[model samples]
Target: MVAWLGSYGTSYFGEKAYPKPGAVIMQYTGLSEVTKHEPPTYECVGTRDGIASYHSVRSYIRKIKKNGTDAEIQIFDGLTHGFGLGEGTVAEGWINEAVRFWERQVK
Candidate 1:
């Protein structure tokens, strides 16, 4: 599985050099044309994110789901970008959710 944040996440999904991951957990990232790299992808973004628009993440999720892949997304209201593990934000517990999503792929 691949767990990435910010531009790193976009690069992992967009670039072909990296080996294809079994699943992806993307956090606060913009959309990359990743139709070719469809995997069980889990995405999270804050609605108030300025760096990476929440709409981009939603669009990416829609595209992946359209390709018949298992895609899950969580949009946290009133939160911004780069809050790793959501810390004290309303998005707390997102890591646990991502872990569960990854575990489902293994099964």
Candidate 2:
């Protein structure tokens, strides 16, 4: 099973790619158009993100779950875009969770 992890525009590509993935991990983007056979997804976003609204991401996750897809989202407090790995920030360690989510699918 294939899996993907990306941010912003790349995340959209991961979502729309052919054949889909076993799981998807995205950050700080709010594209909400869900497909019929979406894979399980793990997402993270900052509540204070200027580029992407956490609200939109939350709404997207709801749609994902409603479509019978497993989805999880983390809305970090007081952070913004381009905070890679979120080192020393509230969003730190998010990648570990995303990886665990992916591992579950591939197993």
Candidate 3:
């Protein structure tokens, strides 16, 4: 739905990434065969990440859960999509939160 930044391309690290919902729908092509025996899933996404909205991730989590799997969703606040890229950027805190969440989940 980020067609607003078509000039910069869909991969732009700026405030716009996903040009349309098709970008998201296309990603689900691989999930069409998950059947019903998959393990629990953990999904972490940033609210401000235009590449993939936290809402979309939540929807996927719901689907996975409906199929009888545990799905954990973690949404970071005030962080951009690139929070996992740079060390000294604003995304560092989000990354730390994700790491902590992962550690807890793994244990």
Window of ten residues with lowest summed lDDT in model 3? 21-30
Taken over the whole model, the C-alpha lDDT of each candidate is 0.78, 0.76, 0.49
**Per-residue lDDT tens digits of candidate 1, residues 1-107?**
23342214445566545545668887876665664447788999999999888998888788878888888999999888888888888999999999999999888
Q: Higher lDDT: candidate 2 or 3?
A: 2
lDDT of 2 by residue, 45-98 (tens): 998888779998898788878988788999899888777899999988999999
What is the clash count of model 1? 0
TM-score sort, best first: 2, 1, 3
Model 3: lDDT to the true structure: 0.49
How close to the true structure is residue 91 of candidate 2, measured as C-alpha lDDT? 86
For candidate 1, the 10 contiguous residues with the lowest summed lDDT are 1-10
Q: Where is the poorest 10-residue window by lDDT in model 2?
A: 1-10
Candidate that would win on lDDT: 1
Q: Per-residue lDDT tens digits of candidate 3, residues 9-54?
A: 4465555455322111111111322434434455556667777777
User: How many residue pairs clash per model?
Assistant: 0, 0, 1
Show where candidate 1 strays beyond 4 Å: 1-19
